[model samples]
Target: MAKTKNPTLYLTELDVTRLEGIASRAGTAELDEMLDALLERAAIVTPDQIPKDVITMNSRVICALEGDAEPREWTLAYPDDADLAAGKLSVLSPIGQALLGARAGKTVDYRLPNGTAQRVTIVEIVFQPEASGQFTL
Candidate 1:
């Protein structure tokens, strides 16, 4: 896949530290690559520096998939916390990785399991843990 210029991703120091450990222990090359990509393009920041509108771990967001009229709500989370039925999306998942650090009103492009390119727009960030001063979450 060709690398495309993406908007700068913002991540908290705590999140980065945890995700780096997860990435290092990842069993799949795809997961490692996804984490690398995210880290490569990320602008690491302190929890207090994170913007309120940016999507962070445990943040509930509303997004519209490309070509889809209806917006879907999801919570960006860790692999162990992922529960599709509950709308918790794993950061290792394509859509989850794509939404990381994205601010409301931004759009991100990602690849599907079938290798199809798809885009999604962040319509709103309903809940951001850091934004709410819940940095430990």
Candidate 2:
């Protein structure tokens, strides 16, 4: 069988810290392995320069699917108590991780737990906080 390709991930200091916290709390080597794998995958996806469409860490944006009637808005940050009530999803989730930093019109293939591939297309980016003139950091 062929090996699966992993993409390089561009994460902010905050996300890195959070991942470290998860590793510490779990008391397992999963986090470390994930980080290593993420870096390797990122290298493959971003061999040259990262495309303009890739989302940065802490980005809040509206992502629309090609076939979906409405766009879904989400942030990369772990939602707070209030945000959770508003339908915000954590970036660590399978779907969130697949969509992170992905540009509009790009086809993203995410592997499901059952070993199936979920293919999605980024139709329109209605809004992106990083693309806008908000916090630069």
The segments of candidate 2 whose C-alpha lies over 4 angstroms from its true place after superposition are 1-9, 43-52, 64-69, 79-85, 126-137
Q: Which model scores highest in TM-score?
A: 1
- Candidate 2, residues 32-82: lDDT per residue as tens digits? 675555544543232123344666545555656545778677655542321
Native-to-model Cα distance after best TM-score fit, residue 30 in candidate 1, in Å: 3.2
The lDDT for every candidate, in the order shown, is 0.86, 0.54
Show the lowest summed lDDT stretch of 10 residues, model 1.
1-10
Task: At residue 131, give the lDDT of candidate 1.
Answer: 78
- Model 1 C-alpha lDDT per residue in residues 80-130, reported as the tens digit of each score: 999999999998788988898888999999998999999999999999999
Give me the overall lDDT of model 1.
0.86
